[model samples]
Target chain A: MVLTWAVIGKMTQRDPLPDGTMRHSRRRVLRVGALLALGGTVPSLTGCEPFNREPPPPDPLAPMVDEALALAAAYRDAATTHPTLASRLTPITEAHAAHAAELARITKVALPSATPTASTPADSDATLTGLRELERAAGESATQACLAAPAERAALLASIAAARASHLEALQ
Target chain B: MNTRTPGARSAHAAALTAEYAAIWAYGPIGVRLTGPAQEAARDAEATHRRRRDTLVLRLTDAGDSLPADQAGYALPFPVTDEPSALRLAVEVEERTAGFWQAAVAATSGAERERALAALVDCAVRATRWRATAGITPLTTPFPGRTA
Candidate 1:
């Protein structure tokens, strides 16, 4: 166990980017450290006490759910404004809604009731382009979240990220 | 009930196996496609190969045992035509992404990054295959998740 932890420690050190800066963000470094500390085999520290001491700062899923909802709303608004694109946009919007619901269920959090601010693109092509940009940003966020997440949540985050990437392609 | 936990090595091994299968599967997928589609299949195959090579190096450096690729694999279904081939391509990418998702759960740090990137790659490829196949929606709410 000790050897395993040491191996993980060595592996977590960020590689230099092309510009010679470390790849990890400060938040990622902290998350990695917390994950490593949890991975350690010290029996006394493994009890429920440490984990139960304070609730985690916030569930990352909250923001993820919000993003999904917002994306869905944007698609819906786009569809309403450009009725011609409704048939094409509706399915993607519905998929986003489903994603938000599933994420909320998994996190055991109540869904947010706030209405999403919709995109007011001027024309059909602009709507599609705006959607493509939205999907790209969401995909990037999900990718970063996947990298920062622990083992249990990583799969969900990765899947969401991948879905968003595909959404971008489909939007094109 | 068994309480055993599988580690990062096991997950990485699973991903390697999926990559091996993906590389083999693309041979049939490419032959059935034409023009740009065929070129795309070839590019996808190369991507899997590159990932496989990287995984081999990472596992080797970590002193983890590597799984040997099979001489051949059984296709999920017969790929005798273009439609079947496109479907197989989609299946291949989705299946490979599943393994990478598991790897994301089992590994950490650089290994996790690799798994996440691979997962995204497979997802995007799967979407393209779906589009080529004329599958409706063309994207999933969750790429790797079955439920």
Candidate 2:
């Protein structure tokens, strides 16, 4: 049978179960339906709780934010160590910071205070090389995260992955 | 291949539409570029076409009817020169990435894997186009998102 948009819209508005328990399959349906309805603007499903439900574990999004911040720090530290590369590196660094902020906002979590670990480059060339390595690693991590992320968060993770991949090319 | 979920099937269909557009946009984008840039556009177009074919097969196997492509698509802007062509390339990739992003939110398992790969591919391509255009900050914080 053909799946019409109207049918999917109805699925998203499903009421909570009588006992206040939701099946995994049904939850997946609701999440997908909501995503389609929002046109990908919905950040996360955290706010979809019906009420009286137990809180979830550490937010899955926390790691993504941490990774983004780490990438930003890497770029910033590299620029500081090699001032000549500052012009080329600074904008991307800020982009990473923006990513971290957005991810934190969507996840409804505070930004972590701990500083990210950064490499100390010996020169401008080394700084570019080191940054390339960092971008590659970050891209891989983001791709893996996208693969495992829930439907609600997969788009964000995929975008992060893609951005990092492009960063790798730019560094070249 | 669980086509039982209407959301997943519909999202996949949407992705197919985006892929169709990407393939068509590349025709104009490639002709305006030359040398290595031209080759890159050709490669990008080939990749989109391959993806579109693969998605068609998967959707068919999942028992969903294929959506028809548009007779023609309106270019976001006129592509009268090299720079404009590159910009269109970037826009096409970003637009397609948005559809795959939506698919990621609407599917699971191997289907989700396909969606994620498509999303990432479009994003990376867009970034490369931005670099070619001498657009600074060669990457966006979020590839498929507007806000």
Candidate 3:
């Protein structure tokens, strides 16, 4: 009923993160080992192949890191598309950048060199609404990640989640 | 496998203490405002009271000891005007959310959920207060992070 590691798998399927970032976060060795053992990665009859040569499972926080970067990009694009709203939207974009940087640091994942460019809707109100929805979903995902995280990591996830949730009001 | 309401006991106890402080501070905040703002203060106080009672019961059920609520908490700044009261309300919620955030780290399962709900609730309220006071940047980058 409570965090059976299924949550991490769920997040993995929900967000398509770059495979490059998956190599980081050594803390995941145990989880990866558990996954390999459970998956029966080897076909050898003796099952004595102690090594799980298959690539490591993606770090559970990688998607969040990716999501943070995406949100930042979306906000940045929105700001660029609608210069009149830049004053209000710039701070949120900056916040997401900070969140992404912190998450990347914690996971030992390097951020993408170039921020992806996303097309913004023609209507500024529509763009703002779209941003709000993204923030809302991001907040919900971060909340789940916080619950699934180990104690040491939960605090940052909690803050990220809360910050995202508060952004709804900022958008309004 | 043991799963007896897992979390650090001290964290939730501290959250309980925060609720007590929130409830206490709302008195000065409520007195400074009239109309809907006053009502908002009343609702906020009642919310804190309910959470305090619920947490007390939960800790008791979990066989975890609780810290007692004090008679009063010193106000960070005097609530002299409507603006100041609104500001205090925001501060109270933010500070309360910090404790809940720590609880979220220290806890798991239902306790973590409760702490998270409290944190979100406080963050939202803090935002509302900021918006109400005409402050810029309604949301903080990290709601409960002190720095």
Query: What is the RMSD, in Å, between candidate 3 and the native fold over all Cα?
Result: 9.9
lDDT of 2 by residue, A1-172 (tens): 1234443444446455779965445666666666555565233333544332545556777887888898899999988888877877887898789879978997898998887878775877877888888888888887777778777777777777877877777778
RMSD of each: 12.4, 10.9, 9.9
Candidate 1 accuracy as lDDT: 0.82
Candidate 2 falls in which docking quality class?
Answer: acceptable
Best candidate (score: TM-score): 3
The residue pairs in collision within model 3 are: none
Model 1, runs deviating above 4 Å: A1-56, B1-6
Worst 10 residues of 3 chain B by lDDT: B1-10
Number of the predicted model whose lDDT against the real structure is largest = 3
When sorted by DockQ, best at the front, the candidate numbers are 3, 1, 2
Model 3 Cα lDDT, one tens digit per residue, A10-47: 32332224874334233454664465567554232123
Candidate 2, chain B, TM-score (2 decimals): 0.95
State TM-scores per candidate: 0.78, 0.77, 0.82
TM-score of chain A of each: 0.65, 0.63, 0.71
Per candidate, the number of residue pairs that clash is: 0, 0, 0
